[model samples]
Target: MQKPEEAYSIRVIPDVKIVNKGILHTENKIEGEEYRSYIFLNFERITNKGYEASPTIRDDTLYYVNTKRNSLVMQKEFGQPEELFKLGKISKYTFHDKGILVIGEDKTDKKSPFVASKLKYRFDSRGLLRSRLSLYLFSHGELRKVVSGDFDVTDVATNGKRIIISATKEGDDYGLGDLYEVDVETGELKRITKGEGTVVAVAMNEKGEVAYLGHREGKTPWSTAKVILPELGITYQCGKTCGNHVLSDLFDGVKDRLIFEGDVIVSPGQEGGEAHLYLLSDGKSQKMTDGKIVVRSFDYKEGKLVYTYSTPEKPVVLYYEGQTYDPNPDVKGLSPQRVEVNGIEGWAIISGENNPTILFIHGGPHTAYGYAYFIEFQYFARNGYNVIYSNPRGSQGYGEEFAKACVGDWGGKDMNDLLLFVEEVKRKYNLKGKIGVTGGSYGGFMTNWLVTQTNVFSAAISERGISNLVSMCGTSDIGFWFNAVESGVTDPWTEESQMKLMRMSPIYYVKNVKTPTMLIHGEEDYRCPIEQSEQFFIALKMNGVDTILVRYQQDSHEHARRGKPKNMRDRLERKLEWFDKYLKK
Candidate 1:
């Protein structure tokens, strides 16, 4: 659907101060289907066939890092596509102060079992990073550091003199993170802040002001602090005297002023909600947006402001003038037919006005696709194919019962609900019985599981998915806790339990998959790490199934959802490419 430019919608234009262009996206709460509500209303877009889109621009070019494969890809021209660089787990990069910071690790640790290392890079004017550094936990259980004298030429970030690095630390009691500033020319290290609490976000101002979110002096509450160089003086505190609360990095580096959002968190038994947005300048502040606007994103250019806002009754929209318009209004280029299967309601978002549909299975095993910002489904719909997304059994927000229905029956009832969704969408829409199913995380797991359970889908995209529950039981973030609940396992290693885990694992049943499949993962993701993708890809390829793997470096599970602007764009592009190659006509 094409929207008039004057229509209201929230968007991110190029910031005059940064000369960068990126879109601000949001995911809101879709009311009706509460079962899978957590996964609802995420704002995203599927970009050009292979052309990438990003939320931010860095260096001279836009760069996106895929953490699963451990690679960095750069978007060349404004309207052109991106190219990926394979660096493995050796280095990480970020754009700061018009310079690129490169952090390279020596090797994985044997003591704390280095899942990953903290890296920082500082670049010179010529776009060459002079200092490459790393933060590591030594065998002594103490955090250690390293610096590299080697100079490398990369286009990730090509500006700046001094670079501040952030790293997480593990100690005898608990874990925290540290921040360090390194001299690019000399490879000299200056420890900025360490110990106690983690530095969540960092922003450096033109006047050498470093603003960040951190906990100070073993304090219980997290606050935003603006610190000065040299003596490391703390000037401003957003939450210091306000009590226990977390401030947004959006408040950092606002220059002379701080935007204080009153009480971001809603305490237990609290009614309604409140937030305050303002511009802090010269130790004084002015209100920017009212607290009642229900804004998820806002960007100010010149004196005009563009933002997105919605109420419970209205779908998400952007604002301009006095009117609001939908950025993606049910893609007129395509047609989707609604369907209800086995008492479950759903619809197929088609690629074109007429074509077979791609059955988009949502994760949470209990989540549903409703009126929210989904660029992928819209992309497929606009491109002339049908895409179907549904909230199957075990999805959330459907009161607590429906959300918990699939809790213990991972591969059983939830899978059945999806299959029924597909059958009903096909029957209702006359979809020619051709469907391509895809999802990420839990959805990826389901896609992997789906191909094994049925040959219905012609193709599948399993993104950052799980294949082996037995292995994942020992690897994932909450594997230990959730695996027992799902598999009813008393001992993860026990033969009987292992067999059951295998039975439910999609990789084990790869021999039954007839549909071509693709696997995408982030190398740095702690949630559903690359191992799961690797195992699934290997199994499928070994079984002679058409399979491909795309891995992004330094990209955690949060990359696709929320990472650097460039990464977010590249993720959507790559995902669309996979679907374009397999699901599209």
Candidate 2:
């Protein structure tokens, strides 16, 4: 254990820009306190105002998205940022061999901002969808509007003349998107992919061949996601290894996930819990990175690869440059022992037999717990608690069908997997004073459900969790669609469907919660909504159970990750105090 004063301190690398001369990385120090960014020039720190967080290199020039100004800027060496395109809040800018592609909004469009006229307008972390993203092509110092309409484009890649994008409303609006090719000169859009489910990223080779990273038609939205080359009839979906990077990291040094060198494709793919850059050439793929490591982001040029990578035990030390740019070297904690019992893969940090145990469940019922550095989990391990976490059913990194395993089962098998994993860990470790459970989002829902199902856990904390399915459908931003697709609720308004939803809801069995529980939710959480926690807290009180509802204002569903620094520190302290009071005894 270490001093508590320096406990909530977090250091991260937000943007890592790779240039010809050297590597440019922005490091944020002292999280939740005074924020300071340090820019490095080839492993050495430098400062430049015009240089944005994540800048792209195009013909010895830099191009970046200025979110504050809502513009795309061009900057040469030792020059001020020149506004190239001032579209509404430019989120992404791509530099291809042919030209530059920018995506943002059209401020000239006369429409009420942040207001959606549809059933599913709002989303978690991303609030109301007031307007769709507008795509523009900046070629030869001239800006041209290429795409803006009913279709919401998720990802795009270009060859200057041909633009390949992924959008949901291109044809049969089943919320499933297709790969559409847009001819920039003619302003024509054509769908290329056939069996489409969900497309996360897209890429195009020099030969104008398009490839998408996603799954085909599946049982639900949480389908097996992979990179597919329809022309080559090649799908990069793997069961033994993760087809893409699915875990969250401390520093997401932005660069590129998909790289096309001629017909050869280099992409980030995860093996087990760690991610590696996989090169796919001649219709065959092989990993390029060595050792057990987690690559957050990477960029390549002139036969040299620059990356920001980390592990549970350490930080990113660029292998090519032979330099270490560790964000928090001094802030080290307990390491984990990877384990798998009954097909449920997980990690367990064993301090001692006397220490209590806390089972950490990941959100996304779709996201997996992998080889990423988590400060909260590290703190829990440092505070004399043996931590156990795993990717149960409906988790990514385990192929497509496995992710859809809990499509209609929700808390059924996933809950059982967690319970079973924890029991096995407890027995294998042979020492546990008390057991606690905690998670956010979907994990929060499981926390509430697990407590009600078994008395194995002495305390539990649910963050941004779901309790009532019937209310969530109408209240949450993505509730209507998420519930229908995830929970198999075809008709939510029907009495039969309502009964089925309630039967699967945690609030329906709140009376069965014997554990001392804590509900941590955001007042402005639009995904699960704050009402979920309030309802569960009220029911727990009515049943004479010890429960507390902690709410954070000015925060959405991402309170734990990207919330206010002070708020993040306060959250950690609150969880520690709650578990200490209930589980320490």
Cα lDDT, all candidates: 0.49, 0.74
TM-score per candidate: 0.49, 0.90
The clash tally of candidate 1 reads 59
Give lDDT tens digits, candidate 2, residues 209-277.
Answer: 878777676436666556788767887743344344455534343433566657777677765577778
Clashes of each: 59, 2
The ten-residue window of minimal lDDT in model 2 covers 248-257
394-434 per-residue lDDT for model 1 (tens digits): 65324335556676577888888888777666666566635
Worst 10 residues of 1 by lDDT: 263-272
Residue 250 of model 2: what lDDT?
48
